[model samples]
Target: MASGASDCHFHGNAVATQATVSTCAAKYQKDLIASGKIAKSWAAVKEPASFEQIDGEKGKEWKVTFKDPAAADKSKESLYMFFTAQGNFIAANHTGK
Candidate 1:
């Protein structure tokens, strides 16, 4: 997490605050770029296209989506990053599955 980034807090349970989740998503995106999983142009995107909480069979999860106009494939244009309720990264994919 970056300096002064919002801290994760608990509301009944250990759930990450939206700001904290957003920061996590951003860091994950940067990691993707560094690993050559995504275009370096992704670094230009300062914010996600959307952020939401998903309710699944296991439990709650956070999704941070970013749109990259420079992507070679339309299906790959949207990067979906998933994080646990506690702000721990789970996985990332273009399929959003």
Candidate 2:
């Protein structure tokens, strides 16, 4: 799949490309901050620290990680957001595990 393309559909799912997943991850981060679910300091990190595709028991999953240097606790500095191959948000937490 081309990096410029938004996504590719297979079966009924819209499989997201790297660019598409990054956009989705950004939106999810913004929404979390807006909803007060996460610290506003997270906004300081404009870009994700990493993006990864994992093949697990449930199938393909996308992980977007952001490092918030302003976080009070070092353990909570890294925020990990998860999504489905289709770009659907799954969950988020400090521990990627």
Q: Which candidate is the best by lDDT?
A: 1
Query: Could you give candidate 2's per-residue lDDT for residues 13-90 as a string of tens digits?
Result: 567777877887888898899999888888888899999999845899998899987789999999999887877778
**Every model's TM-score:** 0.81, 0.82
Which stretches of model 1 miss by more than 4 angstroms? 1-12
Please tell me which predicted candidate would have the highest TM-score against the true structure.
2
TM-score of model 2 relative to the true fold?
0.82
Query: Model 2 clash pairs?
Result: none
- Report the lDDT tens digits of candidate 1 across residue range 1-97: 3333343332445678888898878888888999998888889888999989998457999988999887878888889998878787788999998
The TM-score of predicted model 1 comes to: 0.81
Q: lDDT per prediction?
A: 0.81, 0.81
Whole-model alpha-carbon lDDT for candidate 2: 0.81
Model 1: lDDT equals 0.81
